[model samples]
Target: MSFLPASADAEFDLLCIGNAIVDVLAPVDAGVPEAEGLVPGSMTLIDAQRADALYGRLEPEQQTGGGSAANTAVAASLLGARTAYLGTVAADALGLAYADDLRRAGIFYPTAPLDAERAGGHSTARCMILVTPDGQRTMSTYLGACTAFGPADLDERAVARSRMLYLEGYLFDPPAAQDAFRRAAEIAHDAGRKVALSLSDPFCVGRHRAAFRALAAGHVDILFANEDEILSLYEAADFGQAAAAAARDVELAVLTRGEKGSVVFCRGERTDIAAQPTTLRDSTGAGDAYAAGFLFGLARGLAIAECGRIGAVAASEVISHFGARPEGDLRALAGV
Candidate 1:
């Protein structure tokens, strides 16, 4: 399973923390999103009842453990990085299955499912992703027990032992989770481990732009964002302005631009990486997969440009299929 050589100094090469959600995917007509009052290609929060109703209305094509950071953890594991995930699920069948899936993928998931009784009767989080013909997915997520994650759920030991700590922005929506991420960042910094963050969505950036900026400038060593998300974060006039702002904020910034490829800004240098060629099927986890490959490459001591190239390859693989994860041999596709 060792696709790439890695340093064994740390217990895990990358430790990811965020929401633990099961993704239920189904293809529907382009009008489905509008019919459900959901904007196309946007993620919206829904309640339990709403989630249940939506699930019942559509025939599911796939159900798998997925969350931005969790996806990155799984993909990174497939690429041979020692990865671990820390997120809250619930004491339910779906929750247990999610945990099992991560373990099966060779990624450690250290948190136990939250007890439903103690978690205010919240069940496992679920996301109903309705994909339109154009391969754009509209997500309706029920936070469920995932929002119960707090400082107590943070795996301090794992954060301190990992070589790098990665955070997902969606989880930062809750005040408790925000505190937990800040605490985790502190722990990683104290241990001399690098902290990376993914600006999960453009909506997320709008919700916490000030906080994200503060963390990027002080806590996070590496930042991941797509073009839209980065532009939103900086409130910049264009891509160039946004990239400059990101370079000034973090030690390294990996910005993905769908068909335009990605750019890596580090130490006042810019490395432009071309997007990998692939027949697109779904773009659901493009950013997550890219983060996985790029972070895995960094953990494996590859050059920055090579890291971006591997990221591009990983992202391409994910989008060339129906599922968020790669169905192909990622190692072979990456040519590692």
Candidate 2:
């Protein structure tokens, strides 16, 4: 059987796989947390009942589409690349909303709806993001139907159809999703395409350090991480050591250090790109946006340094907005 899609013999620009979630964002007064005795800036996973309890207490300001890899896919599509998304959601309103949102962003959606029993009883995955005055976000995620997303949910055809496959680290927390990650990597490599991965969060790296190390050494061609996540993955004392270790393992390693800009390592060559100046309104999608810019540049065969610059610009724009998804056309923003 041929690996390429029947419509085109060439590879798609990018294919992303991860959770399908809807983001419910709200602005809270600074002292509200202290008054309510809630911890700030931590991500807590809650069951449907607990999620409902929390949702009842807060006023939802807006609903935006989100999920780490999904956000990256959307940004990649907006940057004028052909992209596809793989994930799971129920056949409910939120799930339909997620599908519609990705479609509007010009990304191909190939997810199957969950069983009616699951959809009827549980809400789709939702992240309640509390944005504080200092431009930081605290997230509480309700996995809901997302937990049922596993290897069976992956589309083999889509994996073989892309030039690059991108996976998020958050999927590691769910044991059922691990096989899906392995499957995507195998399919992508079999098709002669590259596989990319993001270390989703610092705590996530800490949770699955050994598995991540093994994957980074063998399966991952491109790796995306921030200062904390890199440091956690390598158990390094600081950012410098972690960056050096990552460069040795992956074909290309891009590490972002907020305010200090970003660094890219490729085949023993290192390039540093400074962050573009912008008023920081929110830091939600900065990393995902950076990944989109870098991947877009890579797909276009741009120089490594140029890719880092494009990533920096993308990160800058997202930090200036309250949402993880881009507020404007990134292709025009990058002057592509």
Candidate 3:
């Protein structure tokens, strides 16, 4: 089997696959999500009409580039890792803007834009995130052109050259996208590179629990999930039970429990890292940023505890801000 730095040609530290989306964020009262028939802490898929309706009701405070995997890739790049993104967008204004933002952030996005003639009238994807007073973010996403992402988008050489392949569970909705996910995992594993996956949301876990469990058991080297998602994945009674179960399936299982902190399980060993203390703001991209920090440390060959600490520090910064993207230099904040 091929191994890392296999040819003295490995070009990147991380390759992330997921939907490419722009995020429009605004602070709202706790009741806004409920008033819009959305679960207070859940991410729900909506169409363009629904997205427009929600956007009209709220005053947008920030319109920035954001996607689960993209956010992680960006944060990782800022932390000094060579990161690349694989996803699709329409050949439209938002799509071009998204590409430009990623390039400016020092991320390599190599996916081809969808041809307008063949785009079926879809625009670039947009996610409307409503942050509540308690720092919880509720999302309504319009997938748009992202649904067109398929296995054909994978760049074989790019996958083979990455140290780790990071996947966002949100892209598994489309059958073709699932095929692409499996193909990417195969490429990474075939090259003896590790694969990391994030269970994007609890409801997302509910939608494909069986498939995700199988992927974690057979393909994933590192698994990231929040308390609710891990519990949902295993159908266990609590965190302990779920974590125990998760440890048996993946080489490393990382579980985040909001204020209680996070736990990492590997080879019968469990380490708990305290959440970094910070003034809470919005929790929109905390998990993604945490993954970025953890992966960054892993790429640098840091100890597991140090990796978790870096992740905690990265997460703390995102939660202390309003939008999903970081406002300052995360590398400076991480002291990497």
lDDT of 2 by residue, 170-215 (tens): 8778787887888889998988888999998887888899999999
Clashes of each: 0, 0, 0
Better of 1 and 3 by lDDT: 1
Worst 10 residues of 1 by lDDT: 1-10
TM-score list, all predictions:
0.97, 0.93, 0.97
Alpha-carbon lDDT of model 3: 0.90
Q: How accurate is candidate 1 locally (lDDT)?
A: 0.91
In the range 1-336, model 3's lDDT, one tens digit per residue, is: 112233356699999999899999999987989989999889999999998888898899999777899999998998999999998999998999999999999998888789975456889999999999999899999999998888888987899899999999999899998899899999998888889999999899999999999999988989999999999999999889999999999888989988888999866589899999999989999999999999888888787787888999899999998988778788888889
Regions of model 1 farther than 4 Å from truth: 1-8
Candidate 3 accuracy as TM-score:
0.97
Evaluated with lDDT, which candidate comes out highest?
1
What does candidate 2 score on TM?
Answer: 0.93
Q: What do the candidate models score in CA lDDT, each in turn?
A: 0.91, 0.84, 0.90
